[model samples]
Target: MTTPVSLTIPTPAEAARWAPEQIVALAQANAAAARQLDALQLEFQAMKHQIEWFRRQLFGAKSEKRIVDASPHQMNLGELPVPESSPPPPAKDIAAHTRRARTTDYAAGDASALFFDEARVPVETIAVANPEIDGLTADQFEVIGEKVSHRLAQRPGSYVILKYVRPVIKRLDTQAISCPAAPEGVIRGSRADVSFVAGLITDKFCYHQPLYRQHQRLGDNGIKVSRPWLTQLTHGALSLLEPIFTAQLDSIRASRIKAMDETPIKAGRAGPGKMKGGYFWPVYGERDEICFAYHEGRSGKHIAQTLGTDPPPEGAVLLTDGYAAYERYAEKCGLTHAQCWAHSRRKFFDAQALEPERAGQALEMIGKLYAVEKHIREARLVGEARRAHRLAQAKPVLQQFFAWVDAQFESQGLLPSSPLTTAMAYVRERRAALEVYLSDPEVPIDTNHLERALRVVPMGRRNWLFCWTEVGAKYVGIAQSLIATCRLHDIDPYTYLVDVLQRIGQYPAANVAQLTPRLWKQHFAANPLRSDLFEISK
Candidate 1:
């Protein structure tokens, strides 16, 4: 459904209308629009495009990719067809179909009954007594094997409190009293164990559960715990992980090709009932690891801090959108800056309603580029072979795409400030940066990988909403970086966190990189240190 874009001024024109705020923004950007008739009309269409963009953000589908489907011709003038008295066509029989078998067993009332992984689960056996078996002799029952059935069962929360009862002994010689030093808590002399701390961090940051919610759940489960203690446990765990996070961040900085983006969060307090704004600059490395670095502002300085001050190697690539700060940083660092086709395509997609034919043509051209990329992946092209594939397949499409944009501009028919021209200019100007991926095999076509890695922040934002302190936000980044990297490597976040929380105290400081998810998978993940609870449960 299309939402109408409304303007405050009635009868602005019969051609287009825009939202009031969009008109104001356009007028501010182009001061002459409010004065000249031609500029006003152009701003009308431009603002219409802006209004559609806002509408798309609020109510439209999020995906920007497109498939080129043949649109039927919508007009036929001065055409007439003779009516023929033809016999009715014979009807064809339709085939009967059956429903696909599902995983849920309705009769037994068990969900996921068909997809159970038997090897991973330990079986608990229960014996049932039948009246016939009561009367039968033991020899008769002993002669036959038993039949069994399986059902997946679950308990809420699945948390167990270990009531440790350590023996207390007094030394008779010196009247010295002693008990096993209470198994070390993450906090000095605190009762909370490393296992509890690991679970709290995983549930809060990785699962996106806020501490107050966990506190409420703990209360519901008859376990009395304060919300502040959970917060403190999280801080304590992250404090131990700060060095490892720094080490991983260094590894990400050393990668040849990287993608980076910023996201805002409400961190710290501005005033009463207010929040100060901050950003997390997340960088994705070639080694398949990501680091989320927190900074108070979105600027080039933060980019320099995360990447480096010195210039990158001769062929290093950095993928990003047309964000000005990234472009500036890339230029300053002498990196081969590549732009995202998805970002360019998104602009034309948003302006589809304003100029359907132009937008459709641009979209069809961009679709060809993506199709070449799809074939490259399907063929499993790698290294120099991948670069050669892009050169042979994608390079021609890229050339055609840019030449089409240049033709549209040279024709001099489109409004100077209209969305279509703006989109064409955008692609035409970035031709150099957008063509970088054609020659470099390791560089990705877009920053979607980095965007995906940083999504935990936004997904968790919906649940937790905001952070009370900047320090809390930093801790959030620290935990999320490792957790996100763990996911990239297909490692379990809960298992990794539990083992590291126990092992970090004794792990060598110089070998801290071994604990980062990328290195840990290769070295330490085979037989990681386990908490006392894990050992006892086993």
Candidate 2:
């Protein structure tokens, strides 16, 4: 007694038959499942790409150069039927030639010329006697012209502890004791003098030396200085320099066109044995002066605060990377916003690993733009000439590039999350900003200038690691700003810092511009007191 199961086979019509409500529900469920699958796939792809990016950052060629030999005419995405033509020649049939030998000129002329122009450099002459006439008497030796050869030399810097002896003198008539007031030192009570403080700041910021190491160096030279004391001296020096730094910032802000960028630095302020991230926002002025400002975070508010004014001086154009923060700040301030073409190209360059064909096309087009820039630079075109050159050469290339981008979006088969799609969106969004360079000669095509100026922050970070506190980071920014600006003007940073430190206390605050590296070069560089560390050959 088990009831036999009825074995039945359903007909095609019965199998296909279903209630209308059931059919609709089944179709809706199928669509929902597909949608979920697509979402998961998109998420997975995004994660994969992110991991790949990190891997490349950790281990990849640092250079972004891409070499392509094909002509621009060959860079089309269309597929067409092949036309009948002569067959291509085999590689073996091609002609070959011997490689040319490369040579270098190593003969740097006249050793004396190196120090000849340095009037302040002390010269010591060593006389060499003729070996042929040994032990020649004064009567035998004849007074003749001399032959001299010069060789550059160096020695470790000498440090000394100056003990100022101010003798007390009494006036005979008034019976009042008076002594020449001791010359104003950078720090009144500190043992360190202006030169010492300037050297410390220069060594720390310009040479990327840490205070503890500098302290040890001094100890090795028989001068035992505590790290804390050195730190205090450094802070004091920077405090004196703060006014100059502020003046430079104001000058940079007043410029009609400027470039800006930021780099992160680890500042030890979170807690003991911990560090917090901070940023150095560097601004490049029209006259090639660079100013770095430190802030706890990279926010639009910090940018606004740094500028210290709304509606940035008329005709102001701020060139920067396509950071949304800049856009908001610019909009609120009524400043002209220009984006970096190099940044746009960088996006496409990174995408090359994922989508070579599309990325290469974008890179080639962008390369054309850079080529035009190279021509403009080689010609030293400026103002109207530069704008006209861009209009004539770059405008057409840009038109074609944008047209290609539009066509890519309109054509089917590109996923929104694809690297190429993302790059296209990035360029399209910043198209107006990117084109600003074509219209204005003062506006650079990229913010690479400011980025290069800010590189010192990262390089110094590599050597000195983190600043002890947020305030320390700010001081670092102030010192680095002056040092970098000095370097930009081909001025010796140590000399500039030392002279500025010695004179800044007495310099009128209203005329601080004279103390800046630019004006200092024009006025004080020719002074006999200028340092001969690396004097230029006349």
Candidate 3:
């Protein structure tokens, strides 16, 4: 019922005698096929690069440092090429230099000497008797000097109750009774001492101990306390500290140069039997101070609100990664946006396994930029001098690097989806923002500082898992902000928290800035709380 279709095969002579238009069409078809093949090859390369990236993340070393090879053919981004051979150096005329043995010994020699400030640390002296002189009498031998060594000891944490004795007196005239008032506490009528509260907080946030574990520890130590009670005590302490936390935020906002980053946190109260995701946006200030702000979502509006304006105040330079939200915020707020070079470098770093030659070229150029930064940092250059140095050294490298990126993009005919093409586009789009550092000495080359600061949150999350409520996560952010800032300034978190907890109530609200870690160091540099005071009474 259906007619069969037949095709005729053309001979070589018949095909050659075809019209000019038909020949042109055949040539165009072949060209199109060639283009498609090229596109597919590019896509395959991109997929290969992606697979390598995942493998590196899952199995390879986490460090960004590339391995060094000693082979003559090895290439290095940080140094010059090695020579094939070198001449031997001239032999020294005299014997090789030798030094006389020194008599003075600079070794610690004893554990007690290991302490930089022995006066600050508690020391217990033990009397040692010589076994050779058994049953020695009072007139046995003269004592010349005693060798002193110390073994550090620690006592398990235990709860102590302070019985405040307020004497009550009765007046004979009117039979009126008067009693001495007790000092104000972090939480009124709560039996927990300020030091106890501080220890609980530091244990949870700084040491990454969960409150449940601490509760068990307390019970194991023969102190009966409920987990809920401990949680309440922590909340109460954080409530009192809310003002100081606010002040720190204000201080951070007032900074001219700030670095911003965000990390995830899980809040358990968001849904029934399921955890709700949240974010903690950590902002690092110009003075090395860091503050964490909690938000339900990582959006530009939340960031804007935290900074206290839709656009941050004028004259502020905000450093961030290549997040489009940040760019939009910067554009709206009129703030100087400085993108992170380390972020751009990471793209090429990830592509190295598949495109080593091209990636290495890009990395070497970026490495030169960092080398300039290293030189300036080593010289301790700042302000105009730092800017001048960057202009003199880094600006030229940047110009050449960008030009090379543009050339590669135009001439290579890479697919749009290729990783290398994506990397080039990333740099090409943010070229101006990346160059902001060359003009302003205040801007850092990367957001590595903020990224490093964010590590604490992730570590804390691993131990504690998640917060019970949004408010609890916020409290965590506040406490962690202070603790991390203390560590940044080399201040002991326990010492800072205890002192601040005891004094925060008495400190005037208008003068709350003094309670911040950086300002506190300036005010209390010479009179830090003694380490012995942090110890529990025996």
| Per-model TM against the reference | 0.76, 0.75, 0.75
In angstroms, the error of model 2 at 262 is 2.4
lDDT of 1 by residue, 1-538 (tens): 2223333433657225667887676656454433465655776886787788788789987777554554567433444563598778899999999998855332332232233333233223223333343454554443122333332221224444433333343444444444443345556766565666777888888899899998887666545556787788789889999988999988887789988888999899999999999999899989999998888888779889878787676688889998888889888878878999888888898667798898998898788888888888899899999999899988988888888887887885688777788788888889898999998888888787888889999999999999899999999999999999999999988778877877788889999898999998888789877655565556
RMSD of each candidate relative to the true structure: 14.0, 13.7, 13.3
Of 2 and 3, the candidate ranking higher by lDDT: 3
The prediction achieving the highest lDDT against the true structure is: 3
Give the per-residue lDDT digits (tens) of candidate 2, residues 1-538.
1222333344778648867886676677666666776777667667777887888789977788996666866745565556689588766766889987855333333343332222223333334444433454555444333333432221226443332333343434445544444444667766565556777888888888888888777666545456788888889889998998888888888888888787899986677777899888888999989988888888888887777664567789988898999888888878889999999998899887677898899899899999999999999999899999999999999999999999999999776798889999999988999999999888888988887788888889889999888889989989998999998999987778767877888888899988888788998977724322223212
Error of 3 at 252 (Å): 1.2
Write one digit per residue (lDDT tens) for candidate 3, span 37-134. 77667667867877887888899998887564488776567677757787778787876888998654333234434322232333333344444344
Residue 53 alpha-carbon offset, candidate 3, angstroms: 2.3
Residue 143 alpha-carbon offset, candidate 3, angstroms = 48
In Å, residue 499's CA in model 1 sits off its true spot by 0.8
Cα lDDT over the full model 1: 0.76
Q: Report model 2's TM-score to 2 decimal places.
A: 0.75
Give candidate 2's root-mean-square deviation (CA, Å): 13.7
Candidate 1 worst ten-residue window by lDDT: 147-156
